[model samples]
Target: MSDTLSPKAAKLHNRTLITTYLYEHKEATKQVLERELGISLPTITQNLRNLEAEHIIELGELQDSTGGRKAQSYRFAAKHRVAIGVALRSNSVCLCAVDLYGDTVQERTHAMSYTNTPMYYQRVGTLINEFAATVAKGGSTVLGVAFSVQGIVSADGTSITFGTLMHNTGLTLETISQSVHYPCIMIHDSDASAMAELWFDPTIRDAVCVYLERRPGGAVIVNGKLYQGPNQCNGAIEHMVLVPNGRQCYCGQRGCMDTYCSLETLPEEGESVPGFFSVLEQGEPHHRERMHTWMEFIAQTIVNARSVIAGDVVIGGEAAQYLDDSDIAALKSRVQQLTPFSTDTFSLHKSRCADTNSIVGAALRYIEAYVDSICTDAE
Candidate 1:
């Protein structure tokens, strides 16, 4: 829950907290920071001073006081530090560089099969490093790396235990990080994507996110925190057998959401989801129906999730490229037809639209861990 170090970590912890909030609100006075951070005046002043000295944060114009003296406000220097996040699925890898506020600064991706092989990791490492080199070229300093993969990630961001959807190659975090060749870390694909929503999304203070990429996996966010259970695979929902009596999933289950909803369910050679949609666009009613079934399955899953950790469902993946207004509406309609409610609260999200999400999420998580390490030492 906290970062490492004694006084330095305490200072970085406070800076991370203050800067995190400021990244959202844009600006806040010391009094507002005190109320939100719940720290003493000296601690606030001290940390803010340290952050300013480090060029990680900046002070803006003062806010008018209510019948009192004006107070100076603080804001995160979004450009001062840079972070990288990478989302690696079974078929492809996406790497991005993001700013302090989760803004994509630079990004690129490489195409590869998710199956575990030395070549795949080598390719992934090359892509990430290539993007980092791009970041350096753009004159932005790189801070750290975050890796989001499809499997069970350790809480410490050190290793992956179960990767049902990845190359099935059984890769070790140590090996991958060594290949990564920077200050690197790892996270579950869902949790890392959810971190994208957490540090940057303003409306989602509380919600549940079910992210589906070409690879089937997801993470849940409760009270603005990713709920990672022991072994760090709490929300890896693709393994959950929804039908228990249907199609065989890669995870050895019948009729799971992943089997029905993923592109893998649709066999093709060297095809993108956009190409699949293009087929539908060319009037392939069968593919169209496949999409409809996919959305319906997603809806039913959300409706079922309501009994547990329900709030709002977000659909995001490489498949999101073809999610037109009509597709989204149809998905909503299907959910409406199946669920108790008339209106659909589940939202569709797209990360491929943002070039820097992976790097950004990685950077943010790294910074968060850096701060979390500091606080626990004191406790």
Candidate 2:
């Protein structure tokens, strides 16, 4: 490699860099961009003009003068573009539209069965198009859509390789994309939830997000990026055999972690996880004992996973939000005692996104892809 950029390539690189920088910082003065990007004043000005003309960025305010003329500040026009995230569940599809700043602009939940027929997919497509039109009313461009499915997703994010909750296997992206007429990608729901945790909490660069939803699963993050193993099952912790011959699992396995750690294990007294926790919080001895046992199982799984992966464990999904700080601390203590390694501290975190983490994360995937495309074009 020559280790140098051609004039044309350099210009593209600088433009992408400036745009990305503004996106991260929200707003910055031209002087700050020039200093940080190490580009000349004229080059920065030209790039800013180009970005502004494209409606990607706009002048915000004047920077405070330092014994000289004040410089103009710029910010990304985040509302100018939007991305859609669809969370496909067994009984409903939850849609969310997120702006460039990762804020949810609109959300809607549509009730539907996870059918393996074209008619069902077409209906989903129509709903997505109608939602997009609603979002576009404000003159925002619909960049793309990402679907979150609770299953094993293809490495390319184009299909559902396998799913225990969904009736369809090998479901192509076109099943939904054909109706919406937009770029689309499919993501494992667990992976999407983990991405949401990483997005909200930057401190968690490397961690295992244990998703304790209706269908239990997990996602592995290493070096600030998702690490999909050779078979794209790197974080399929739910399949880990907890007992040799215990409760049966949907994956045709006996005593799988999912059988013990999933929401299905909870009592039917409450309709939702939060409602169940409310009963526990009221000093209900039966539910308390049940929760204790559940926490113990989760602790064991975390210890076993940490022995191999060696990172913080974040409990995510609908149930995580209901777990108080004391509950998490107790779980951490249990994991510490179970682990063989000598560790002074254990990093356990609760998910910030309540029930919509996966939805936001799905949208973030497309937004990140958009940014990556800009950088790739520069390259």
Candidate 3:
């Protein structure tokens, strides 16, 4: 968007824009890209050719012959340029890899021991490399690694200043970035997920989105861009105390929203948020009662944030996987009970991404960085 941007950088930027478009549209012909990107025919063809050479995308079979000629459609070679994304959770680590699109080509998860300054970084470091190596398709180049830990990332992504679960945040960035043999980037899970939402769901563009995830984060998206606060912690809502003198939080706060409603707070062991919701659906009164109380508490916090942020709220997380569309609609009804906003503006629901949502989110962060670097070099 800047004239000062170099030609190469601009091309990379356009490539990114186009890739995002193709990721959204799945398959597009040259004419489709020309219209969608507003680029000349030669430029579109050349970029497509270059991308194809890089194995970023490939031409599909021809569509119906139009008024002129049957044009070949291009689809992402999601297996071509791979990137790994991982979320650092208190109880476990979630890993995923995707293409330019937020489509998870591969994913894996495992329990991680508590984070020590060094051991945690080493463990996460090992996991990232292993995941990338194990699942990547043939001859694909892993562009970079992205992580969406549940804390505030430094402006330069050099360190994470806050994370009870991510104890190695400060050291891990440097170590991982140095040792990964790829471009390493990090972002708060809240904003990372927001980026994933933007790429994965274009209907969210020019729209404000509120994401409620189990990792304890929030984000404000305007016109397809994430609104990170000046401190790069705009969505740092894990510390927001929803109830005074209600419960103790790991962050040394009383009654933080996470303390009350996070899926991690479920009292029973061996119960995931989704699993609990399943039991509730089976007419288990115990799960139903606890879930109702949790939903009410979450609804209250969202009502306040909704009034302040004022957008369509998207309820997503590992908890959302088990919830059907009807369940989300019902949850929306529950949130409306507390909010004065008209039902028309409220769109509360579960993210369909399941556990891979954050993983795809992490991949996008690296993809953006990859595009930026290419564009910068192009210029």
Stretches > 4 Å off in candidate 1: 1-53, 57-76, 89-93, 111-134, 137-139, 167-170, 179-181, 266-272, 282-284, 340-359, 368-379
Ranking by TM-score: 2, 3, 1
- What TM-score does model 3 achieve against the real structure? 0.77
RMSD of each: 6.4, 2.8, 4.9
Clashing pairs in 3: 6-379, 7-379, 8-378, 8-379, 9-375, 9-378, 9-379
lDDT per residue (tens digit) for residues 114-161 in model 1 = 646677677777887777887777656677777876677666656677
Per-candidate local distance difference test: 0.68, 0.84, 0.71
Task: State in Å the error of residue 97, model 3.
Answer: 1.8
Stretches > 4 Å off in candidate 3: 1-59, 62-78, 134-137, 205-215, 264-275, 341-344, 369-378
Q: 11, model 1: CA deviation in Å?
A: 11
Q: What is the C-alpha lDDT profile of model 3 across 142-250, one tens digit per residue?
A: 8888877777777777887776655554644875555465677887787777787777676774333334455466777776688886778675566678888878887
Provide the lDDT at 65 for model 3.
Answer: 86
Over the full model, what C-alpha lDDT does candidate 1 score relative to the true structure?
0.68
Give the TM-score of each candidate. 0.71, 0.90, 0.77
For all candidates, the clash counts are 19, 0, 7
